[model samples]
Target: MAKDRYAPKTLDDLMANMSSRMSSYVGKSQQLNQHQELLTQCVGATMAQKCRISNYRDSILVIEAESAAVAMRLNYMKMSILSDLRKNGLADLCQIKIQTSPRAAADQQAQKKRSEPIHNSRILSQQTADALLEVAEHAPASLKTKLEKLAALSKKNK
Candidate 1:
């Protein structure tokens, strides 16, 4: 045979056969990129030396900052970032993940574990007191007193 003109020959022709699906994919990609930019702005609130957007795919924005300190600082601002993402209506297609390459996400997970309440109690118990001690160990001065009182109150309630 000399040629089969009807055979699928090019990417454009292949896409032409499925324009509806391709258009939706393109639209979603565009929406995701726009939301990623908006969430990227929240990075500046943390005093990050430089915030760069390395990738915006699958609704996850991977950010690279100039330093670990900056990344660590940004960690405390995650909820604010997430709120901004939601307030601006970008939450539907966007999420923020702070990436400091030297420290793995494991570090973040550990930090989160440290930050969150290790135990849930209707009323605080001795175990909760230990959790309070754990929190007080690293709590900032401004928060220490309030947290202490909370721990005390929870303990008394136990």
Candidate 2:
């Protein structure tokens, strides 16, 4: 008996069909990748690392920079970047846009947090607790609560 043509196929078969359908898109994707690499090379390592090609469409390349300062700097290099892209055969790359994105800043903050040594909730030493208790007597009520908490933490640990 012949298999039903409209029936769903195995995962591999489905993926293969989808891949074939997307073949045309692959060329444009490669061109975009090339444009990004070329842009990086033209701009130099330091600035390029902070900027990335966010979109490419209709002769415009939208670049996302880490901050407004970087975006402004890239804006100044817009013409130079366009000339370099044109030279490399991407003549359609006529306009360059620089946009400040908070994503990079957030990622940097997250990375810093990850790399930082975590502070363990420390129990105060007996000597330190005694000192806090002594100081708390003369301390204003506002400071007393904090000192008492530390003294209590030290006692609990004993």
Candidate 3:
């Protein structure tokens, strides 16, 4: 049996064998994440939750704020944020760009909606229940049972 030089022994070895471009992209992603953390710390918890570092390229940091209000606030504090980022090792940092992203706020709202418990508060009225019972009387045995069960819900509701 011949040993395969290209065969990776473990996940770490496989990752280590990744192309230079992929490695560079991963490094850049990690660096951006670190910058995001530093930015959040500089902005404070309240404002940090409303905005995020979207990109860092050409010495310009792009910040995506959830709303216009947040964007305006970030715009007002841009110079301070730039200085803070510079102090935190982004010495080449030149400008801070703030963009209002309604989509981000919409996404958060959708997530909140998904997390909330759905409430079905609809109740069968007595008149509707009576109509169902009347129909159930002439219905086939199988359908009659289901209609009766549905009509019974009104009594339970009352």
Predictions in order: lDDT: 0.68, 0.85, 0.91
**What's the C-alpha lDDT at position 119 in model 3?**
92
**Model 1 Cα lDDT, one tens digit per residue, 10-69:** 988777879978898788678656755675566553453245445666776666655687
Q: What TM-score would candidate 1 get against the native?
A: 0.38
Please give the distance, in angstroms, between residue 120's alpha carbon in candidate 1 and its true position after superposition.
65
Residue range 1-158, candidate 2, lDDT tens digits: 99899998899998899898798588777877877799888999888878878788888888889999989898888888889889987876778888899797678669989999998777679999889999999999989998898798887887
Worst 10 residues of 3 by lDDT: 12-21
- The candidate, 1 or 2, that scores higher on lDDT is 2
**Model 2 clash pairs?**
none
Q: How do all models score by TM-score?
A: 0.38, 0.55, 0.58
Write the candidate numbers in order of decreasing lDDT.
Answer: 3, 2, 1
lDDT of 2: 0.85
Number of backbone clashes in candidate 2: 0
Alpha-carbon runs more than 4 Å astray in model 3: 1-18, 108-158
